[model samples]
Target: MAALTASQAPGVGLGGHDGKGADAAGDASPGDGSYDMELPPLESPNPPGGSAPGGVGDKSGIPKSVLAAYKKAAKSLATSTPGCGLRWELLAGIGKVESGHARGGAVDKEGTTLRPILGPVLNGAGFANIKDTDGGRWDGDTTYDRAVGPMQFIPSTWARWGADGNGDGRKDPNNVHDAALAAGKYLCADGRDLSAKADLDRAILSYNNSSEYLRTVLAWFEFYRKGTHAVPDSDIPPVSVPGLGEPGGGPVKGTPERGGKDGGKDDSATKPGKGSGGSRGNGDKEDGKDGGKGGGHDKPSPEPTAPHALERATDQNITAVAGETFAARPGVRAETAKGKSVKGVKVRFEIRGSTQATFEGGAKEATVTTGADGVATAPALAAGAKTGTFTIRATAVGKNLGTVDFKATVTAPQADKVTRTETTALVADKNGTFADIAVKATRKGKPLAGTTLTATLADTAKGPFFSVDQQGKQVRTPVTVETGPDGVARLSGLRADDKPGTYTLTLTAEGGAKVEVQLTIKG
Candidate 1:
């Protein structure tokens, strides 16, 4: 049965009925018996605008397809089985309490829940264990069948009460319309009048035996009936359904296991399980087994064991250049308290320091499972653009195990080596004015474009050198020039002062590399 709670929504109770003395009719039955109740005319809570009371629309977070199916099923039940007081809100309430309208999964326009929903295996730990009934055809567990569909019906129960709400001829539990109609029919069976508080409680309890389940369904029912907004209150603890609570709360191992492809028989529907009020066992009473007295003996449920153990992530230190990719060393491991390796444990990797340093080959917040060796390996880690240290954290699912942090250091890029060459030496003409001297810069024999070259005379103010303007007048001795694409820089119009002699010309590149050339001038 679905373990929904409405503590989040204030004002609990269904239309003022508090469920006290509501079970006077009898303990709720798992939806399996055939009802002889008269079918009432079908009606819809939603008006022409497809909005229910309290102005709740799709914004209520209830899917439109699911809401429409509820209305359709309610109308179908009322038309086919009159005088049952089957309201669309009541059907919707059941859907919400059972599976969150298929846990925000896919529901098509034809009122079909395209995604298959399965509950956990009833393995006697926080649940009743029933052997497989359908050869793993329905719940996928040949050993034990689970409840299936948005309404959370066990396969055996579905076989007994399944109906084709969409007129599809096939009665599929995964179809919302079919499941909704089947639920409505189950609620109105035995000619139970739902207009009365006692009858309503009896009908809901019949679906699931928990008093808290009744309150939750009714709370959602009232929420829909009044047309209030559908914000679920966080304060209210969610009820545990097969595969919908803590690991072992449901058939699967995870929190709020919405739905999966597994199939199984529902123990609550077949046997007198947790919420069945200890009444009928395995649908035998109606079949004339023990004459209405539950004759099947139930074994005591097993106690919950401690959670699986997880060790801190190993190889937490990594170093790399900015924007470089490297393996995330120190893989994480999952193990038992005895220090033995445990495989298939889910480990979540989270980025803590910089968004730039990401888990390469996967999502930033990716979850990877441990391999056979109990070690979970992370994809390559790419450092961010800037140089700094960041942290990546690997934590076990549910944190029941533990977590480890990996630190990464990124450094700046290194500079390249360069050399300077003078393609042409400096020489003075008869007037003692020198021609342009061409110099080239290269890094490892390849032209190093964009290098800056500066020329300085051995003596700035003395006889050897001087610079000239466009008009041929002496200017200065030191000059700065930038190299072009071919790595060539030109120093033009160097003039020797009237005193001619051999002079030293120093050419310096940006990185402190210098070349000295002898210049000869004629007076």
Candidate 2:
């Protein structure tokens, strides 16, 4: 049980590199791995202006192969588990936390770690007592199991969750693709939607079962949520920030420190010794603080006085202009199981799903404690430049009533003026694709970015149709394209009909600007 989260289970206390046993974490049902009952208010894990790997990612310091692996896993999971709402950012958050993107992108082109990044053995001495489940197959330890690979999955969990994400036929935890997809599957298990805080908390807790781990992973999750750019696959040496992404923000015992010139050599001291952060919260043999490291050890997190349930206290649906504040402040109420008002319980309000919106300080999430009347109101929400609908999730932290989702919409003030960038007539032979079709969208002579232009035939019939291959069949349908930084978007794959005739194609931008193109099909 220690290996498969016997000690890493939620409420098992802060495990993973800490020197402590399982501590009571609220009313978490042991290994059930859900915080729907948490009463703490939803808040951002990353504080505003928290120090990040300054130059690593996109300034996204993630290695190219690692980034590709994350994205590839996410994309594959979307098709397999669309309800999971898995995003690459979550994988990056775990990768960043688990092994700092394979120790600062020290992996080969196939996304395998240059050297084995192993954790201290779970020998029941100071760490979780997890016996070998992979027969020393993955962790190379036949006596006891160890958390292995970039995602730091122990053998038992890997046995159940391992997947061949890269489709290499063999499920290898050392491979970033397989490990990342496995992490996504583990997080999304049991129909969990990552957009919800309760589900997200449970997913993370099931991985490490520590409040500190939850907070750290959430911090990285939110930081990545803001933005992450792909870095080059160049041989950038590993440079881990202290207490940023690693265990307790320091080096684990038996592992090379971040930014250390360890030359990607294999770890000889794989077994964590007395003072290393190998044990779960049971630090070193001396004082149980940060496994003998300089930092303070993780103490048992204080459980919150939770509320029973949460309901919308204000309008659940809101609308505002792009880049403007909504008139209605999203709010929710906390109640007990008996429907009694619960006061002082924190309710966290967070932006969820697709949209660019934030509270003050560009914070995508916020926490508000319930008032005397049991109601918690969030601050005014300012919509970002992106125009679309999304949900604002409210969770009664530490309480398991699930979450309340509020719908919000942001509208653009005006439509850009869309004009044809290519004046050439769209002439195509029957069944031939119309090539070199392009459009530019601008507002007041300035190019617009992220402008949506939907291209369609004036008449669905008797006109050249946009043919696209779907599921091995060619289907005719209208297509939408978005403008880039330069405000230009292009189109292709428009096929001509057998009847050679003149037709008109229209490209309409979201804000109402429309441009017409003449299409001539030859027989």
Candidate 3:
């Protein structure tokens, strides 16, 4: 469920929308099931004054050329899903916000290409080592990166949501047409109703996966729209699925099938396996020696103890988001040395090292086994977890004893959420330092775009210096500034040396969040 929050106006600068709740547009019936209608082509809403679409220099930084590209792309997608009018400028805005209009090549911190919208590019050459090899490794927890191409779909997500828009057989998310169609299709499935406020808001939430995220996107939309209107219905085409009746209609089949050409699945959908979903490696093979040895050995036993040990219990691997709670399914394997299923032996899951933390395994233990199905789960942990490599040891004890090792790593969360709140001392010299400093806040390691920040500084003996406004304006008194899309605010040219003592910098944000720092000036 989306959290309740308010939507703030754009002029408020750094502070996002203050209004909360979904738009009350058309509502779908509960238990209505999924939509199975033949899908229509996508379309765009008409703008006010019917003026030419806003371009980059509309002073909004949205280039006219890019807007034109959006229009062209929207036209083609409209052919398949009618009543789907995605704003040309919104598409451009997303491109700008995500990957700097493809100029920066949307990359994670480790420099790996990310899909602008849908991603985790399945079947791509770089999927296996993406976590270790990519330059833009978000915080260490996220396996995906910023994204490449105009669409900005993260690689992993792209693997699941990508499609062949031009029918060229290649599902290139970087292609503008393909990306735009996917964006529109994603919104529709998420229940975006251009005509209704609630649906549109909910659709936005679906896009970012959070209510706060939806508000930020909408605020940006409002800023870009300024005088523009929604894309008109006339430009959109009706959906055309062979079996499904029409767009938004109930699903033709009870459930959307998996492993299809389009790759559309409900967010709440589940996959097969003994765990919550499935594991990264082979799900059914079990092989290794018993746990009679200690936890820190370098290699496994040379030969398999059970004849089918390698075939029954498959090795499990996971990349954990440091400081977050996650569960591993099929946590234990119920097998004997012969690879036979053990009916009543209780298996235990444990972790060792500086990476020590806790899970929801009922006790200090992460989890226990009920039967022979190899399954174990872990509880959530606190933030600020120690960063490094860790080992997960799975031990099974029935009449006989056995153990296995599955390698794992713990890394920081991606940039979406920032964990390190720092206070650095600034040196003031003969040259006056830019008094105004911008504090960029990140949530989940990703920049928390559009946050409002208020900075107050009191010199021990010098009193107040000057306050800078959001527009970089220097005012005589203290002032409040909102953060931009990068979650940054600047207080330039402060008279640090003039104070000659300890100065305290405090920042308070919306949602009642606050951060403070101390600065020392040396003569």
Q: Find the candidate with the highest TM-score and give its number.
A: 2
Candidate 3 lDDT over 1-523, as tens digits, reads: 1111112111221111222332232221100111112111122232334332222222244333344445655565466555655665555545444333332222222112222122222122222113311222211112323233445444344445555555543444445455555555555553344547766665554444334444445655655565433221111111111111112111222233322334343232112122211111121111223433322212211222221111114336666566665444325445322234445445555665556555553333554544435333334433236667665566543222334565666665433422223344555653256344657666655676656666666543353356446996544454577666777766566654354555676766654566666556665
lDDT of 1 by residue, 1-523 (tens): 2322211112222212343432232322332211111111133223325443222333234556677778888888788888888998888777765666654434544554433355545544444455655544445455655666678676666667778888744566767888888888888876877998878987887676556666766766776775623322122112222223212123332223224343332333333233211111121122213234322222222221222344554665878766567644547777532235777778887877654777756457678888888888777777767788877777777543435777778764321333335445666754567777777776556565667777888866555555566896665557787778887777776767766677788778776666677887765
How much lDDT does candidate 2 score?
Answer: 0.63
- List lDDT for all candidates, in order: 0.57, 0.63, 0.40
Candidate 3 lDDT for residue 163: 57
Q: Report how far off residue 232 is in candidate 1 (Å).
A: 18
lDDT over C-alpha atoms for residue 470 of model 3: 90
RMSD of each: 20.7, 24.6, 26.5
TM-score of each: 0.37, 0.40, 0.27
Query: In terms of TM-score, how similar is model 1 to the real structure?
Result: 0.37
Q: How far is candidate 1 from the true structure (C-alpha RMSD, Å)?
A: 20.7
Q: Candidate 2, which segments miss by more than 4 Å at Cα?
A: 1-59, 234-523
TM-score of 2: 0.40
